[model samples]
Target: MESFNAGDVAEKIMAAIQKEYKELKTLNVMVLGKTGVGKSTLINNMFSEKLADTGIGKPVTDKIRKIEKPDFPLAIYDTPGLELGGQNVVNALLADVTEEIKKGISSGDIGKMIHCIWYCISTPSHRFEQTEVDFLKAFLNQTSLINVPVIVVLTQSYSKADARSLTAEIEKENLPIVKVVPVLAEDYEIDEEYVAKAFGLDTLSEIINNVIPEAVKKTFIAVQCANLEIKKRRAQAIVATAAITAAATGAIPIPFSDAALLVPEQITMIGSITAVFGIRLEKGTIYAILSATIGTAGTTILGRTVVSNLLKLIPVAGSVAGGIISGATAAALTAALGEAYITILARVVKGEMNVKDISTAKGKKEIARIFKDLLKIKRDNNGTAIESEIETSADNTNSFEIND
Candidate 1:
């Protein structure tokens, strides 16, 4: 933990408590924009699952998507597409937000918290339709969901220049701009740095440091501490298993001929399967598809050899000898490997490691202290930002009504 500057037990407690209080409650982040602006795709990517459908066609996310994250639960309401005609479109969009907000109220704690809103738009064209502009104006003017941060995610950005120009233009809209996160989904520029920036680290950190009630924070920290203890216990189990095997083998010397041959193949197969646990392909396919298959294969064979020799104490070669060697080795190693893999996979799936979870008690406290200092960075040239800007003019025309 120190190598990564993550602190000890105290730090984990501090960070965990802060994060829990600030983020534990259910949050609804509405993805609002014109039809076909990639809102569903954004949520799908955020969740790392096909929770919502996405394509070039017209908006398919007519309903809302409720997703649960590690820290909090949320419902991402994808509003209906606005009509090409003016007032009718405004009414429809307004109605949708209002209904969702009410629904949130009905849902109790999760419903009441609309922590953030993201308005997605496509880039380069930088054109706004009447429907789009009207919707933005109506949303700003009519909604009571104030103070909630609004981010403009520009989808489909190609060049750096596009991002730069768009960021500047968007700031001029008089909206309470939080950030402009750029996405080049087609180009694979989707990184945690940008998304975290969009989510307002300063605010989030503040919540970690100060906003959450102290009692709640303590409970959350306790849960994380419990989980960490479980990991430590599993590791101890593995060590004990290995030590017992070694002691048994030292008492007797059995021929390694049959055991040696079978052990490597078994280890190799297990290692290969474990290595490709999340992959979509079959077990055989992983071996054939991955270039590192040979390395994985070798690791398995070596691992088994080490275990077999260490298990030699039983008298005379028999099925029991093989069973003890195989069972103990596989059980110990498999449990260790499975736990480790799940921890890594969870982070990969969630888009970032829990820095707060991994932080030292002191460092986490410092991070909590500096929560207010964290800032969201904006990218200039995304598609979502362009649509937001284009819609600004119409919003301006109805300024008195929307901004009121």
Candidate 2:
């Protein structure tokens, strides 16, 4: 018997399981934290709903309550906030979500996986108790929930710069920092940019209006648009060349700094190239290779171009010879690739042939025929060779041949 590695076999098993259970869609999230830290507030902000009670002075939530929404259905189980020296909050949360899943299996509403774990913490600086630290310690030890994506919602705080330091400390200690959000429930004029960033949305307004009423939603959306637009426009002005080079190369060392500054300019240059040649390549697909090559060559070429040009102006080599072109060609290539990428993207957005032909009748029939043909793949009489041997014995030689 042949042996297979656990990982390879497990991957095949998982693929089979996924195909078998494809109907399961909604992602259930379990929110756990100390009371009064704003788990309810976070959910309300997420769904644009006032369903979860806010301004609760104390830990009013006692049981695991489910918070559901329209566009995104969240079986948000809000467990009782962790106490200073009482029952462990992590245990309570895990138990609750596990029970919910069990009940769901019977009730036919079980979600496939736990999508998010929003661990609401007010501010680690203010509440760095031994209990919290121990809880965190145990939290990381539990590998059972490793598959679930967790985000530490640092609520009731301000300034991303400050958040960065806090996040760095946690990361240094090896804590999973999916996202850090500083939210103020009282101001309720929530910064949608942070929300959009945390949730991976193109625009913040898309999420805001759905939560607030028509009149208030309109006002909030307008203000958010203005604020975000101003930030975007200002970003569009300065081109951080070194940062762009780093981004292109994939040696992005900065943590808190934005990748946007570097990416867009490179993207624009690549887009230009794509447009000219009518050929497209994803910046992401070729970013590292191009960035590495272009950064080195471009740097050299640019240096020589300056030297050559300067030498030409001099009486000795005036117009006879010029400095080596450090960046001209590499820069041009980057620009061309960027342009081509953009043109391709635009065509993609306009609905070109971007979809896989898996649903076509001919394709389906071909797949079915292939599967039917697989039945022909049989072991030889010796059974030593695993080959596509469609046998046609004398008794049943009606007319059968192997089809490719």
Candidate 3:
């Protein structure tokens, strides 16, 4: 009989993670701005990996460089400070940028294409200079044919009044840009008396999500760290789909010995969630989660191990048949597992927990507690079809909160 030992299950999940990640289409973005506009800070805070500081930046052209991390599915075409000393220099920079976009278009690969552009201005400047306006006019006219979306990012906007003033100024120009967004990418200390908290990057992230092609969104969500709600919505959708599939797989009662039947769906769900959160996971971490949540810390199979352990840890589940489990039972169990894992990953994303702790004794205990707790809430009785868990209803909001 086919069975998934904990080691085998862990290997399967890791393989699935690799497969899903590699399958993601690379997302390409172009950022243009003068120096001191806080572009690096904005980039680092908005994405999962610090693509600005940590990525390998090599000159794609004398004026533009491509920043990329190894095996990461994102390419940021970055420009050096745009002093805009002369019309000729601005024209040269525009030429280099457009040529690069043209190359991506010629390749006929969407991954090679430039999906979006950001033109950042320091809000403290308080005025959108005429030189910058002329450059934007020419740049907009040049890229109009290619249909690239450009967003004017007002960076270092610690003062709401200053940000709003600059925003109105830019809006008056009415270049065909996407929108004018003001962002305080990181907290700023004005003095002993005042500090400005980071804001508006989530709005920027959501705006980008709305504009980018559907093909690149999977990679976008996986790599973006600014918006937890985006990641949660995607993870919850994965859980709902996996739950429905698990229900179908167990529609007919299966003996406990055959519980391995539901293992594949659950493994895929776990892999996809990891990809979405874009968290680094070592094999031991995955093994720890499996051991703590599914069974005791030794050789384990999804079938008998889950039912027997839940019976031990949860008294309300006492009524389930010892030898066999129903479809409703399978769906609830799978949904609980998916939701539990989502909560763990969300905590890691928010810095409330660390991935390194997953292998620790305390971490393992907390994980088990979350899994059992979810199982208690997600228990289904009527074998009803599972719907998406992302409804605005308040009930779900409390259940998935990242605990301290």
lDDT of 3 by residue, 314-386 (tens): 3234555646556666777777788889989998999978999888987887887777666656345422323
**Candidate 2: stretches off by over 4 Å:** 1-24, 53-62, 69-72, 87-112, 124-127, 143-146, 159-162, 176-404
Greater TM-score among 1 and 2 belongs to 1
CA shift of 358, model 1, Å? 20
- The TM-score, computed over Cα atoms with residue i paired to residue i, of candidate 3 is 0.89
Model 2 agreement with the true structure over 1-404: per-residue lDDT tens digits: 22222233223333432332232245455677777776676656544234365322223134566655443223466665455456565566545555554454456433534445566677535544566666765564452344444566566554445456665555566665454445544333346644413331223224333433332322232222212332222222211232234234532221102232124444443332222222223323232223222121122211233323322322222332122212222222232233223332333333542423223433223222322232233322211114533332223322211111
Error of 3 at 303 (Å): 5.9
Q: Pick the candidate with the highest TM-score.
A: 3
Candidate 1 lDDT (Cα, 0 to 1): 0.38
TM-score of 1: 0.40
Across 213-312, the per-residue lDDT of candidate 1 in tens digits comes to 3333322222221123222333334333433443333322223323322233323323322222221223332232111111122123223333343222
For each candidate, how many residue pairs have backbone atoms clashing (under 3 Å)? Answer: 19, 28, 0
Q: Give the lDDT of residue 2 in candidate 2.
A: 24
